[model samples]
Structure formats: C-alpha cells, structure tokens
Target: MINLHWIILLPIIFGTVVKLLPLKTAKKLMVLFQAVLLVLVFVIFIEVRKNGTILENIGGWPDTISITLRADLLASAMALLTCLLFLAMLTFVQNKHYADHLFFFLFLSLESLIIGIFLSNDLFNIFVLIEAATLIITILIMYKKTNLSIYDGMMYFLINVVAMSFFLMGLGMLYKKIGVLDFYALETALSQVKDPDSMILPYAFMITAVSLKAALMPLFSWLPKAHGTPSAPSEVSAILSGLYVKTGVYLFIRLQLAFSPLINTSELFMVLGFITAIVGFVLAFAQTDIKLLLAYSTVSQIGLIMVGINMGSPQAYWGGLYHIMNHAVFKSTLFLTAGMIITEYKTRNLDEIKGVFNLMPAVGMATVISILGIVGAPLFNGSISKYLISEGSSGSWIEYGLIFINLGTIIVFIKYGQLLFGESGKKETANSDILEKAVVLGLSMLCFFGGIFGSELISILFEVNFPVEILSHGVKLLLFVGSLFLGLVIYYGLFKKKNYLAVLNAIELGFNEICLSITLFFAFMVIYLKITL
Candidate 1:
C-alpha cells in the first residue's frame, strides 16, 4: 500500500500548476484546492488517531534512500493546527489585491514544506525540507515588491541560509560517524558508540543550528525585522510566527529524546530560554508599531515553550507541545487581525488608530480574545499550557522566571488593550469588507472555544492526565488579576511618558545585534570545546 507521505506533496504540485493557470481562475481553484486539502488533513488526522503512528517507507527501501513519513501524536496535532490556520488565512487573503495564482502557489508550497518537515523521519530530509520552506518564504516576503520587503527578505534569506549551512555541516559530521541519516538509526548508533567525545561536536552544532532557526535569543535579531515588516501578506506573518518557527522546536524535542543519555544539557536550554523570554518581552514592551510588538511577543512565547521543553519532565514536554498548538492559533489570529486593522486604518501606529473597536466590533472581539489568550486569562487555551508549564517545573528559579515573564506578557498586552479601549474619541474608520470579518470571526471562535475546553481536548489527544484543576481554578484567576493590575500600572504610569520610540529603535537595531554577536561567540566556544576536549 502506498503511504500518506505522497499525499503531503499534492498541495505543492497542485499549487505550482495553479500558478500557471489564468489569473481569474487561479483564486477560485486555489480556494477549492485548499478546501479539499483541509478535508484531506482532517481524514488523515482521524486515521492517525485510530492507528498509532502511521509510517510509510517509500519505494520499499527499508534502510537506504528510504523516504519515511510518519505521524505521531505531536505531528498530527501540529498538522491540524496548521490546516486550520491556513484556511483562516486563505479566507482573509482571497479578496485582497494580489496576484492570486502566485500568492496561493507560495502559500501551498509553504504548507507542503511544513508538512514535509513535520512528517519526515530522516535528518537530511528534514534539513532539505527546511531549506525548501525558507526559499518559498523568501519569495513570499519579496512578493510585494517594496524596498522594505526586498531588504527584509534578503536579510532573512542570508541569515537562514547561514544557519542551514551550519546544520548541513553538522549533518555531515553525524553521517561520517554513523553512516546513516535516519533519526532512528542515528539514535541507535549513538547508543552503541563507546566514546562520548566523538558525539559532542555534531550534537552541539546541531543544537546551535536549531536554536538559531527557532529564533532563541540572542539569535533573534533577524526575526523582528523580518516578521515585523508590512510588505509581506498577513497570512505569511501567520505562517512565519505560527508554524515555521515551531519546526525548530520540534527538531529540538526529537533530538533530545533520541540522545537522552549522552545529552543532559537541559540547563543550557533553560538559561538561554530564560534570557530569551525576558529580553523578548522587554523589547516587545518598547515597540511603537503593533506588528513589531506582536512579533517580539512571539519571541517571548517561543522562549516560554523552550523553557517548558528544557524542564525535562514529561508533563513539561506535554505542556510545551500543547502550548505550541495554542500559540499557533492565538498568534496567527492576532497577526491576521492586526493586518485587518492596518488595512482599514491606513496606519500601524497605535496612537493614531483610536476607536478601532467601535468601528469593527468583530475584529475588536477577536483581538480581545487573542490578547486574553496570550495573557493566560482564565478559561482560555493559553492558560492551560501556561499553568502546565509553570507548575510542571521543579526548580524555584525557573518557575519564578516564568512567572515574571508572564507578568511582562500581561504588561505588553495591557498596552494593546489600552490602545483599543482607552483612546476612543478619534473618528475615521477605514472601510473593511465581509471576508475580513469572516476571517477574524473564524479565528476568534477557535481561540475562545480552544480555551474553554482546552483541558478536555488535550487530554483526549495526549492520552495523559491533563491537569484540569490547575488550569480551571488556579492559574487562570492568578494570571488575570495579576496581569490586569500590572497592565494598568504600566500603561497609566510608564508608557504615557516621553519619547521611548528612539530607545525602542536602538534596541531593535543596536542592542539586538550585540546580543546576536554574543550568542554566535558562545556557539563558537561550544565548537572550540568539541575540537579540544
């Protein structure tokens, strides 16, 4: 029987063909194709749930040149989230002014690469898929034909290609030692190897490369610039912040599991995650542009996810994975909504765009839900994972660090809430269409219900004790009251003061670059140790 791996490539192939079709017909065909793809994904999700871990070896090749596609619990959950987000984005972009054929082609190509990354079992194949995704994303970023978009795309391409080169070098080292590229085979080889010395170089290189790709601080400078730019489509922002970055996290988890014995390096991950979380939010709080604020917030959220995974408990792992799904939903929704607001208001500045909620209730409501989710407010999907991550942690320092970051998240979103609700008198509502409203409503519903029943849903998917008590009663109330107060204080007191915009610009350009250089130096130290020790 043929495997579902082949099915993963269908969208890409179809998307390319669609791009070649007449522009008038392309939009209709793209929507129809994406709708069908969504249905197929749902069917695949069902099949995977019924039968544990679907794996297919291509061309009957068991050991060499075998392309393996497998869906574990994590992969299925991610795929589901991706498909849903993609659908919402499609709806939003369907009516917007753009080359419909090219846009859909790039979008589907991105989807194909993401699926390929998630489902593949070979390290080499994962690298290839990641490169493919990056190339497609670069094209998407530059698709708008603006100077800012072109510059951002070039920067993104250069940085990511460098990162991938390091990853390829690491893969080469691993292949030299093990003679196999499959993750399972590499795991077996590492377990069988006697000397730990030979393993350290490849391991360190791989981890660093993954960290860079994932946008862990201080390697996160490129992200805010690349993701914060206005030239890319809103849907592309969703994919970049939502699904694409998570690929690195997934690889980290898989590798950590495979090399559990040789690699007891969670402490490094913990420290890096803590710093990243703190820095991310601090930077986020300083941004004037709403999209940049949200982009930095993504950095902070990704940091929190890493903290959960680095905690090294099964509960932490589960929470990390759960948060991945929740973050994707909320973050993508928020970005899309932001795009809608920008499209309507003709401005990305929060100060100029007053009384937005009064103008677009649907968009406002969606933004409110997404903000609450990010803040870990009660009965929301984000709170469940946040609670799990915090309580699942054993160390006091780590737990407290997470709490402080959560507080900072509250502060950042509080500014957003203030911008939405506080500055109400200014008129001038930008015109918006029906499709935009539909997109916002669709995502809002997901975040709302996803929060309300997160525990039950995750429990069924994970087949573990979902810890409803902490999620329902404890963290929700604490975060709500705490964040609300912090937000009020920060907005009313601090942010209302002088020209912090210059400071924010400096941080975005100067400080972040310094941090990135420092991180690269540390990575080099690890390489040096591998060579010497």
Candidate 2:
C-alpha cells in the first residue's frame, strides 16, 4: 500500500545510504536498490492508472499549506522510464573500468533528483532538484579528465548556471504574484487574477531555462560539447542525451499547461521547433565525429518532438510523447553501439571506421535497426511517431517542414551508414559483455516490433486507443523513399563535391557567445510573445 509520496523518499534515502558503503558493497546494494525502485515505480504506475491521480500533501498536512507531489499517468510513465533507463545504464557500466567510487553516488543521487523533478508538484522543489542534477552531471561529464573534457564540463556548468538563474528569477516572480509555487495552487491563483500580462516575462524566464536544457536552437551551444565530448564516457553521453534532457522537455510541458489559462505560445514554439529541426540536421550533416553526429541528431529529434507537442492537435501531442520514448530507446542504443564501434576502431571519425557488420555483426545489425527507426522506415518506431505527428499537421507547412528536416537526417545517416560496409580491419578482440549487448539489442527489437504493433503498444503505454496509420496507404511511404533517395544523391553528388561543410564544422560557440545567444533569444521571445500571445 505504498503511495506516491513514499516513492521519492525511497530513492533519495537509498542514494544517500550508498554514499557511505564500500565500493563493492555499494554495487551490490545498488542492484537491490534498483530492483526495489523498479517494483515501486511499477506499483505506483498501477495505482495511478487505477485511481486516475494520486495527490499527497506530506505529513498529512492541509493541501493549502503543505508541499505536495502528484502521480498522474504522465508523471508515473516518465518515472517508470527513468527507472528503466537508470537500470539499463547500470548494467551497461557494471563491467567498465570506471565503475569506481562516486560513480554510484553521483548516478543514484542524480536518479532520485530526476524522479523528484518528475513527481514534485512544487515549482521550488523542481528548481532545486534540477540544479542538483546539473551539478552532478557536470561532475560526471568531466570524470575522464581527458582532452578538453574539463573545458567542456566548465562550459556546460556556466551555461546551465545562467539558465538556472533565469529559472530562479522567474520562480521568484511567480511566487510574488501567486503566493505559492505549487502547480495546482498557481492555477488557482491565476483564476482569481485579472491581469495575465504579468506572466509573460516570468514565462520567458522559466521557458528560456527549460529551452536551454532541452537544447533548443540558439541555446543549444552546450549540448554538442557536453553530450559528445571525447572525454565523457558512452554511458554518460547516452544518459545525458537519452534522459537528462527530457526532464527539461517535461518541465516545458508541465509549466506551459499550468499557464494555459494565461496564454498560448504554441504557434511561436512550432515555428521555432521547425527552425531547430532544420538547423539540427544541417549541423549534423556537416559533422565527421560519429558521436557528435548522433548528438546533433538528438537535437533534431527533440525539435521534431517539440513541434509535435506544440501543434494544437491531440494526435500530435500523443505523437510527441510517443516520440520522446522512441527517441530515448533508439538514441541510447545508437550512442552505446557507436561507443563500442569507436572503441573497436580506435577512432571517432565516421569515414575512418568501416565494416562494422563484419567486425561486430550484432552491433552492426543493431545500428541498422536503429538507423531505420531514426529515419522512419515503415514498421519502425520512428515511422509510427513521425506519421502521427504528420497527421496533426496533415496539410500545413509544418508537415512539409518535417519532410525537409527528415531529408537532412536521412542524408546524415546515409553518410553514417558507411561504417557498416568495407573491410573489417585487423585488431585484437576485446571482451564484449553479453549483458550490455543484450540490453541494446533488446531495445532495438522493441523499436522494431513496437512500430509493427504501434497501436496496441500505444494503448498499453498510454492507456488510450490510438489509431496508428502506417505510410497512410503508401503516400508517406513514397515521400520517405523519395527523401532517402534524394538524401543519398545530395550526400554523394553535392556534399562530396564541395568543402562547404567545413565551415559548418568550424562553428563552435563559446561561453560568452552562448550567453549572448540566450540574451538575444530571451529578448526576441519577449517581444514576439507580447505582440502575439
């Protein structure tokens, strides 16, 4: 009979307890802890789905005065994903040499903080948890202490510190106006207010931070460095790309919905999303580093997800949510597999590494499945989510924009697919752990079948009957196939013929540069939102 309130406490307590244990004992304890957490999250999910929502004001205090946590379908689902992803990471890292002290401490603490961010009903708590998570992640990112990793970690820290300052300022403003930071309480306060204009700046402040975290355009300067640094381990990169960033997206959904009665900026966000998506793929196309290419691809996929959710269509909203899950699975698998490939080849350059299929057949096969999913091949997870997102914008420019952006993604991957061909070079074998391989391959299969039975899976995951239209009777199939062919042509015919992409590779933003970009974006958002929303 454990309620939602105890769920947050369980992780935080165990995470702290692990800090005191010996290294070997900590690892053993962690497995047990993760098992308990998985069970707890499952139980919470069941209870939430059964009851619709679970609200707990701590210590049985009055709702008006006490801090509260909520467990609805969305929050519970996200929490469950967090648990599953954390466990997957542990299994991946278990045999790695870096599984030393502070590894468990940082990961477990970060895990609890993330779950808290998802579950907490109070804005103040969310802010604190996010800041804590950022600090821990920064430390983890710089863990290897190799090749500019310290610099990358510092940049990540400085940029996010500024972002959190924005969040804090906005939280202060909201508290001044509403006298409470609880989501429901804020809504209640807004209901009694006459002026909604005061919220625009606060929204700008908060959303800018969340947007930075989500690595949206302009503020996306930190993402490539942090997620693709040569020093950051594969699991760290995978977790950052696969899960940490989504917490920001989660906050965006939560805060925006709470302010729906005040204003709607979905249209502006849709436009911004399109720009981000296009830019993301274009930048990815110019990259030679496989990990960086994947990092940029994440930016592209996130933009598409942002576009989906902002489209004022329920089909799009659900599609966006579905894509979040899909992106997590496939992207993590790609990053992990890419990490292995990079290790085996002893290089990060996409062109230098070849014949993964011959060298590591399982890894190569996983890459093919992951690529198909990312490129939205029929009966893959990406296709289902992409099609649903398209359904919402059926005839608009946004739909067309998705096609164009996807073309860019296809071109990048077409270049990336080169690794699967050519000669399997001479190199000594390394221990390929059965567990890590199984986890990633299993996830790839989930992507495969998840698309084949998308409607059923969607109903199970979301508890709603979602009609999944695949290729829309060959119309979408034609478009995707055309894009793939065109992308390949552009890659070989146009890109290969020129040095133009070199300039794109040189565009790296510094800390001050990122700060300026954030300022410009905030100002633009304020002016534009004032005029429009």
Candidate 3:
C-alpha cells in the first residue's frame, strides 16, 4: 500500500534514529536525511499542485477519531522553502561541530516539529509541535552553556511556556465546546453555532498565544534574547528569524481563516503591526551589537508581514505570504554572513568592525545583496512584495502607516549598512569555509533574481494576476529612494547626535515585566474581542 503519512513521519523517525548513532555518523545521516526530506517536499508539492489539498487520517479511522495531516498551497510551499533552507544551513555548519551528537539531534528534532506543524490539521498536534519546537530551541539557544546564553534560553523557555499555557487553555475551551480538536471539524462546529460571541473567550486565548509566538509588541523581548544573543549559533539565529517565527505567522493566518466567521480582528492586528514595525526599528537602532541589531530587525519585518496579511486585500495577503519566503532567504543569509563576519573579526561590536567589502569580499558582497533585499530596493524580492502590500493599502490610513514603517526600516538599515564601507588592508581574521561562503552567495543571488520575476511568482503562488505596472514600479522605487535618503539624514543628524538610542537601550524591562506585559496583552485582547465579536 502506498503511504502519504511518510512526509510527516519519516524525518521524525530519522531524528530519533540519529540519537543512537555515533556523532560523526549522526552528522552524515542528518545531511542525507535532510536531502531525503527536501525531495519529499518537492514530491508533496507536485502532489498538492495536482490534487489541490491532500489529507491523511491516521490509523484509517474516522476523521473525528484520528489525527489528520494536511497539505495545501500554503502548507506545501512553506514546507518546501523550509526544507531547502534547513538543508542549506546544514551545509554551513559542516566543519564546526559543537556539542556533537546533542546539537544534531536537537536540530533534527526541531525540523521534524516544524514540518509537523505545517502538515497537522489537528489542534493538539499543532500545540504539541509548537511546544516541542520551543523546547528544542531553548536547548539550542543554551548549547554553549555561557552565562548569557543560559539566561537568554531560560527567558525564552519560561515566556513561551506561559504562552503555551494560554494555548492549552484555548484548546480546552475548544474541545469543551465542539468535542473535536480537528481544524475542519472545529470550524464546522463553530459555523453551526448561532452566537459567534460564545466562542470569543477561546478565540482570544488562542490568538493571544499566537501573537506572542509571532513576537508582537509587548511580548517580543524573548526574541532578541534568544535569536540575537552572542551565544546562540548562527544557524540557530538564522532559522529562528527566518523560519520558526514564520510558524507563528502561519498559525496566525491559519487560525484567522478557520475562525473568520466568528470574528475579524484584522484591524487590531494591522494597528499592532504598525506599532511593532516602529518599535522594532527603534530598538534595533539602539543595539550596539550587530547580532542584536539583526534580531530586532526580524521583529520589524514580522510586523510588516502582519500588516500586509491583515489588510484583507488579496494582493497584500499574497505579498505577505511571499514575503515569508523572501525574508527567510535574505534574513537567513544575513545572519550567516554576520556569523562569518563576527568569526573573522573576533567581536560582535558594530563600532569596531568596518570595511566589510574590502576585508571579506565574498561575505561582504552577499551582505550587500541582502541589505538591498531587506530595504526593498528595485529589482529585489522585498521591493516587489512590499509594492503589492502598499498598493493594497492605498486610499486607506494603512497606506500611510506602511510608508512610515518603511521609513523606520530604512533608518535602522542605514546604520547596518555602515559596516560595508571603508578601505581594506587587514588580513584574514578567521578561517573560512568554501561551502558556507557558497551557500551565502547562492541565497543572495536568489534574493537578487527573485525580484526580477516577482510578479510571475505572485501570479503562480496565489493564482492571482498582480502585474508590476511600470507606473507603480517607478513610484515605489522613487518612494524607497526618498526614504533611504531621509533615513540617512535622520541617522546622522538627530539619532546619533541626540543620544536617542541611549534612552531606548536604557529603558530595558526584565522577565517579570515581560510577563506582566503578556498578561496585559491577553486581557486587552479578551476585552476587545468581547466588545467587537
């Protein structure tokens, strides 16, 4: 008998098997396993494209009694991107083996959990996968056993545990009401109900948890500590900023659709997105460490994605979805490049590092391409997707909101771009790997060319026609250039001179404060849902 379940189970089995093998064998096995998983993604992609949505009920039982694995355009596309990304990342760490067997096991397990999330159509499975992912990430974040890493890892773990508690409570409420934990069944059950407001409590609980997972405002401190900390591996940070956070976003979209009939909180999220975007940039500007800068930048980009998807416009929604992929490539590559830079320079301080283009030509060039992509320059992926998002926001206040967010993004990136200039007379500071450099170059090339065919991509992915009209292209480019110029002026004239960055940095909140913030966010959501839904 043919098996469709292998797509979800095979990698997990491989991860479990690796734990029994020797460290060297486990590493090779993982690389091979990742290749197999990537191939499966392609196979599933073709199957999904041809058949629409593929579903598998476990144990050949009734849908209500068994777990379900699902594959659709969104799920398959993300899975494919994720597998390719992880495979490429594995190649980067081929030479530097730290923590030996444990790292590989944890990393592979995390992959399985993420893939499981993409495929599962059951609430319990999704929650379990998320909790599993969170656990694995916390361990990885503390892999080095440094004082800071331990602190950061604990912060991440404790904060997410609290969030997952909210998620579990929501699941309890859901099961109590519908008696089924499956997505389709729950949606069906919810639709048949007369009063949508009766579901508001569970909805608020779940969405709040997902919002925290996405690292929205007031609950995002755990992110920089985990992803931006000096002790986290480059691969760990890359995957977190590039892929894992997108898992939260995926749930955001998925749950939003499943519960659309009950409530529409898109406007609230749109406003929150703008706030996140602005705050993310401001925090980024305050960071002196390059890693922390990129960390906060991830938060800002997620905000932009949130705004695009919540706008209720097809072009914007697809653009946001497409951005999930684009951001993965560019941001992952940037983190990898930063790792290479930090290794070469022996420090993470931005002030001490300069003239990247001259010092490390290959890594520096890739970083340049990545900067272009992140800043939405013409002929880059970010530009096209952002264009779509902005177009969809036109004639609404959201249009202006996006513009301001873009401006803030440019200002912080302006500070980041400074690392690229100056003369090169220095020698090689750290040993380099051909495979690592090659992967960065390849991803950057994708960043560059993905934009050339951006419209075609949008059309194919969402089955919608979003042509890049010349006028729209010209206008967006002009606006981007203006933003770039203004960002430079502000960075040099006011932000740097007035010690604004100092104030933001000094206003740090502790774990207790973060917990308080999470509580406040949930309470506010509960009240808002009650009034609106």
TM values, all candidates: 0.93, 0.96, 0.96
- Residue lDDT tens for model 3, 178-240: 799888887788778888877888888898899989989877888889898798999999999
Q: What is the lDDT of residue 176 in candidate 1?
A: 90
Shift of residue 324 alpha carbon in model 2, Å: 0.4
Off by over 4 Å in 3: 1-4, 18-29, 423-425, 428-431, 496-499
Off by over 4 Å in 2: 16-25, 427-431, 470-473, 497-499
Model 3 local distance difference test score: 0.86
How far residue 526's Cα lies from its native spot in candidate 3, in Å, is 1.6
Candidate 1 residue spans exceeding 4 A from truth: 20-24, 422-430, 470-472, 499-502, 508-533
Task: Please give the distance, in angstroms, between residue 34's alpha carbon in candidate 3 and its true position after superposition.
Answer: 2.0
The sequence of per-residue lDDT tens digits that candidate 2 reaches over residues 1-533 is 67666666676677677778777777767777787789889988888878788888888877757878888888898899888888877777777788775777788778888888899998888988888888999999899887599989988988999999999998999888788888987877877767777888888899899899888887787899999999788988988898888998899999888888877888878888888898898888888899999999999998999999999988888889989988988898899999888878899998798888888878888999999999999889998889889888988988888889889889889888989998867564445678778778877897898689877767767887767544473798899999998988888888866636768888888888899898888888799778875
Error of 2 at 279 (Å): 0.4
Candidate 1 vs candidate 2: which has greater lDDT? 2
Pick out the ten consecutive residues of candidate 3 with the lowest summed lDDT. Answer: 423-432
Cα lDDT listed for each candidate: 0.79, 0.85, 0.86
Clashing pairs in 2: none
Rank by TM-score, highest first: 3, 2, 1
Which ranking of candidates, highest lDDT first? Answer: 3, 2, 1
